[model samples]
Target: MINRTVIVGRLVADPELRYTPNGIASCKFRVAVNRPFKNEGEQQADFISCVAWRKQAENLANFMKKGNLIGLEGRIQTGSYEGQDGKKIYTTDVVADSIQFLEPRNSTGSTQNTPNYQSSTNTGGMYQGSSQGQYGGNTQPNYSRVDEDPFANSKGPIEVSEDDLPFD
Candidate 1:
């Protein structure tokens, strides 16, 4: 049997983190996912219950809060327990294997001190060039800081050799 699910949505509320008797960390939260279709010119969203464990759970509780955007990959879990009324209460939730923050830490407009974390899955090659210095320093020169283009004074077409071509 195969059971997998992926969701990208905003959190409904802050994650609730707790430790078990064994000292294992766990967190429970809800995500509000907007439906693609609209009904009566109004968009509807589904509140999905989710749970995360261990370091992921800790990270979620510490760094994420209500109204934050997030993406998660997990599997559906279902269980039932006896309620106080002597009735079985069925429960369903997504067991989060990985949770990703979908926005910058400062975007929420809060002045709290928090580390700026970017999704490693989509860094846009920010750390690609070099292994030295902070954030994988780029080997390329600081061209963006230049006030004017170096080629702006050139009077004619620049000449290039066939050997300079990177590809055919």
Candidate 2:
């Protein structure tokens, strides 16, 4: 079974963040994902729920706002519980593993409200304007296969027994 999912959308509203009993930070927000097909010249959108934890949650609360575009990758989870109205409420949301800012914030456009993201891996501590400072080099890891034989295994894709796999 495969449970992977990816979505790119805009936030429907400001995120609401709270701390768990153990003091772990968590945030919940909704993103409006537009439908691929147009209906009667109108574009449809689906409101998706997203959750972030720890440092990501804090950054999301501080940086994101309504109408800001975001890219999220996570799995979909569904559950039900009794609500305040004494009714069982079924809910579905993405348990986010990664979240990235897809666009810039308007407030931080001016010098008075400068963007506060940490400089890339270079430029010391000076503010990075517009291009956001590429710094010295790209932040993503270099994936050069220096090994002579990258895949020397005889088998291609794994087809293991039921006991060897986690999913049925």
Candidate 3:
């Protein structure tokens, strides 16, 4: 009865963020996950659709772009609708509960046109970053400098007898 799924992959394109009529934030993106095994000497990859909501959606759209590596936990969702051509279209997507950026802020690969996003562990445990023109407002976090070392006053290495060693 469990429907949980976890995956780590690179984004195939930038996440698209949109607001519902009620002003709720939502994002949609695709991830390219490569298969561990090769098929006839060629690597295979599957493109998965994913959706996120609330602050997670906003953060994802603002900070992530194509070629960025990310890990996500979610549940598989499926739905169907009638298309304009009178055909039933079935869709499958991952409804993400949480996402973790696997790479450092500066390591987004190959997609140079992507915006720079720097995340910090502030904002009540939410990943906050400066929103590019796509999103509005920028609240930079205050970082404190640690100029003094607590061990600066310590003497040289302490001497220990063989009795302190648990093994020979």
Candidates in descending lDDT order: 3, 1, 2
Q: Candidate 1, which ten residues in sequence have the lowest lDDT sum? A: 118-127
Candidate 2 versus the native: TM-score? 0.63
Residues 1-168, model 1: lDDT tens digits: 888899988889989999978676778999999999999999999999998766678888888888888888777889899999999999999977567777665455233344244332211112245554222322322122235788998999999999999999
| Model 1 stretches astray by more than 4 angstroms | 109-168
Pairs that collide in candidate 3 are none
CA error at residue 148 for candidate 3, angstroms: 19
Candidate 3, residue 102: how far the Cα is off, in Å:
0.8
Better of 2 and 3 by lDDT: 3
C-alpha lDDT values of all predictions: 0.73, 0.67, 0.74
For 72-133, candidate 2 gives per-residue lDDT tens digits of: 76677788999999999999988666676666666422223332232111121112254643
Minimum summed lDDT over a 10-residue window in model 2 is located at 118-127
Deviation in Å, model 2, residue 24 alpha carbon: 0.5
Question: Candidate 2 at 59: error in angstroms?
Answer: 0.7
